[model samples]
Target: MNATAGHDAYANSLCRQRVAALLRVPILAVALGACSGPGADPSAAPESTAYSRPRPVTLVGYDDDAMEPFLTRDGRVLLFNNSNDPAAQTDLHWAERVDDTTFAWRGRLQGVNTDSLEGVPSTDNQGQLYFVSPREYASTRATVYRGRLHDGRVESLQRLDSLASSGLAMVVFDAEVSADGQWLALSEGRFVGAGAPITADLLIARRQGAEFQRLPASSHWLAAINTGALEYAACWSNDRRTLLFTRAGDSSNGGAPSIWITHRGSDDQPFQPPLRLSRLDGFVEAPALSPDERLLYYHRRDGQRWRIYVAER
Candidate 1:
């Protein structure tokens, strides 16, 4: 089927599912009251249960092919990296959402010329693009680059050299933009030569007139544990008060990894102690929240491979 037709079909299917769910609410309520004991308050509201059945959202491509997906603000477009084609190297690609739960493959992004690896695409509130490239860096090192998309094309490619110096080997794996587009949360790691640190730490960079400046590390109880050495992926909450990040102990002895949450009053305030979200096992990375802030999507390594999973807040 053509792309447009496929998208229409997917949208219709989603609408039908929502209508069916709404129609069953009355019958479900009746069944619950009938099963309850006499004198029980049937009018009482039901407790909110955690989501168990995994509702898999469809993104175009094979399961093993796509990586590092960044959804647009409207959740209508997904930018990701795919290495499915044998002739072509890994490149940044985009997919358009047909409905709330379905996506169709679009095409390659236009006009950021470089043969080197390009992935980890981030979009600001206005759809400005920021991505990592190893093209011009010395010795295949990755650096952050930003550009503006205009008329279906990217213009004025510029590198963020003030963020780091040459040979520092900086990479921005994931970034989160605030609601007002004033602050940016990024997960950065500095790679030295061989025998470097095993993980990367989270950093907060605020938007100065036209550029960004990294904020100083906050003083929290957890920050005192190992102030200098802790690596994890972090994302800012919609209010920018809470930060969700993956925290792992030392990686040299195969330490356990889990998701943690830290709260702060504002972007400039200190953060509270971080608490673990899940039980210890496997490596958890890429913690992101749904638009409603009720669902979290993350990836965990099972055995030899990694799989995406979602949890309800």
Candidate 2:
């Protein structure tokens, strides 16, 4: 429409074309037709770019404050936080997925959520748990911690001190590890006046032995993901080639939070421009997908409380 907007759109198109040429692999089809073959999700539309309408999930025993749900690889288990309110009892809880819109509460995760703020539960297919905590209750050096989640317990608890917040004004808000344990994705936020993050960026780290380190090359690789917005909740797809993250829209423009997707052809290639997920709206964030990438999970504000919701192809 305007000169500036048109020029920006043209520049972005060229950038995507350049990356596509270097990758030499077919970019992910935005349509759901790829999954329309035999033994696929029959409910998936062969021609649509959107998913089914999201529905609120009922965590039977959990309170009216559930959010940030991480559905297990098998779609049987769910790990989430009750609430993040400082005045309330904030902790991580687990549930058994009873069906498409229901889960049986399994209670607080033992050994991890005691006397502190623990939230943002993320797990790879190997059952490794990655999450965030301010840890004001402990003399910890980091805000992110890792453990092995199994049978309603988090064992081998250890803070990833190496990836801790680098400054007093910043903290790791959300993070996840690759299924192969070779990569780590995190959202480090800088706080200003309010409690919410004033600025945030997604960073990628390469794993070496027991520790993960950020490299200079990751900035180039993730250049398209860490744009000029409130980006957080970084997640790696099952193949580790596709990335899912949330971009908070500007309150000035009446924009709401949106989940975006970007993909690379290989481990070394840069991600293409992020494409906002279709038909997802409202105050939704923390996008999580099943191992097959069929079911999408996120949380939305319902009046004064937050609740987990799921959308399927």
Candidate 3:
């Protein structure tokens, strides 16, 4: 291989290793757009121009380092992890939303969460549960899991063997599946070292048959969303035309992970440049919207620990 290509290869290899090591840690917080085929309905979002200031979420029956809160399309079910602490062997948990900002913890999700890292819970209307876990991280490395979520139990758990696989060694730490189950937005990053910590971007995959696959056409639109920064925790709006993700340490947020958003007129168009959610700030990541798009939910660092918070329109 040429010298430049060889150097690039070496860096990629190191990236995978450091990323794996850091995957279990709580510090490094962790996709872009759908291509043609999905239709758009601008009416999904009301005439609200801004979201409310971030506030602590009153999570009943649970209080720990919350991360990656995925609310179902009906805004009834909530799936998340109790803590990001690897020492705790974090597992996915479920809850039922009692109101806009309160969720009553149901308990641990059976059949999933093992004695390893498991969080970043996501699901679609079809009851397919998707999450990231190091349960098999030693063999799979960068992995995203797929399973059936039913009756508060997860079954037939399996890694996304290909589409959201760590093909390039970049881990699929966070994911968001549209309610319609047509599009999956993944936020990925590779840890180079402590100095740099992480370099991440977003990627979108289209659903084909029973599986999800990357659309080559995503390259054009993804550019507008990636932006060469630590972008992760992708959330798709009800219409699938609007996307919200967290940008870690952008110029606007002073190196803190803050929420940002981008939108397209339709599925055929590329996304516009992302704008930071100026009203929301601080070490916050994982942007999730309510079914009606009236409320936005995310997790933020509260002192030394983390907690889930929300912002309403």
Candidate 4:
């Protein structure tokens, strides 16, 4: 099947599973050990300068298909996106770290999860959530929504209208708000020219007073990192100077989208060219760094449903 058809089929399957779950059906989730275990390919390996080999995350209740893992500053809390049923709405979920190798699933984040698609959560130290949802936007677009996350629940949700008014085109998703809350970076999809192949690239916008203005990609310092291929789902390191995003590639040739990182010495310097996290195998994406930058959490799809994995830095 083509990509769209395959996606639809997957959505339908998940919808059925969700219905069964709601009805108290005793369907057993696929064993996590089937994907990664003591003797599995995804089991832990020796540390390297790059990412360590991934080990599957143990999730409770919802583990069949999960992606977009984000960890809090202290690495005590984890948030990710998962679709449990045919509603096909990817809602946010959270887990608390139980130890170095496991996180106990908490549950779907209440209130913040709507019938609309929501996931890819990023937050600041102050407990504000920045995520992408397609509910209220045009069918071909998704917008960044902000909310106050308090006491483990999302509340006071609203769109960041200032960035929406910046006049970009087509779809916007996977938004990452800077630590200081003064800048934004997100994936944007649009046609390069009339009849040209459509593409997705990362864009940056900075807060100017009460509004935001999209920085010109043509001359923006980050343009170099947003290359010919699609790139999105960015996360900042603890210091906010290093950026990690997903870069797509030809899967058949072993060039599937993987996590990549770029660095700048300071706020005033331009980002250097991005480098792939080559040590971790598989189609990796959605990178989240721990507060100390020693642990990395991401999702990887290697001939299986997406699963969350962690690696030592």
- The models' CA-based lDDT, in order, is 0.50, 0.67, 0.68, 0.63
- TM-scores for all candidates? 0.66, 0.79, 0.82, 0.76
Error (Å) of candidate 4 at residue 36 is 31
Q: Candidate 4 on 1-313: residue-level lDDT in tens?
A: 1112212221112112321222112223432221110110212212224767678888756656787888865567888887433335578988888876688888888888877667788877777788877565543233778888765798888776655523323556668777766777777654322222144567777779755677774236685576555567788876668888876532211334567778888766678767667676666777887777777888876455878888887
Shift of residue 164 alpha carbon in model 3, Å: 5.2
User: How many collisions per candidate?
Assistant: 0, 0, 7, 3
List the pairs of residues colliding in candidate 4.
Answer: 14-85, 15-85, 15-86
Ranked by TM-score from best down, the candidates are 3, 2, 4, 1
Candidate 3, residues 34-135, lDDT tens digits: the string is 111111122321222377677888779786767788887667887878766534657888888788778898889999877677778888878888877755
Task: Quote the lDDT for 13 in model 2.
Answer: 18
User: Could you give me the TM-score of model 4 versus the true structure?
Assistant: 0.76
Tens digits of per-residue lDDT, candidate 1, 1-313, equal 1111212211111101111111111111211112111211213212223323333456656455454556665565666665312123556677776754456776667787456556656676687877665455453333567887543367887877555533434445445666466676665544334322333456667778777776665323225222333444566677888777654443321333456666777656667755555332345555666656676655555553444555665
Worst 10 residues of 4 by lDDT: 33-42
On TM-score, the candidate that comes out on top is 3
- Kindly give the stretch of ten consecutive residues in candidate 2 with the minimal lDDT sum: 10-19
- The lDDT leader among the candidates is 3
Ranking by lDDT: 3, 2, 4, 1
- Which portions of model 1 miss their true places by more than 4 Å? 1-56, 61-63, 83-88, 99-101, 139-142, 149-153, 166-174, 191-193, 217-230, 249-257, 279-282, 302-307
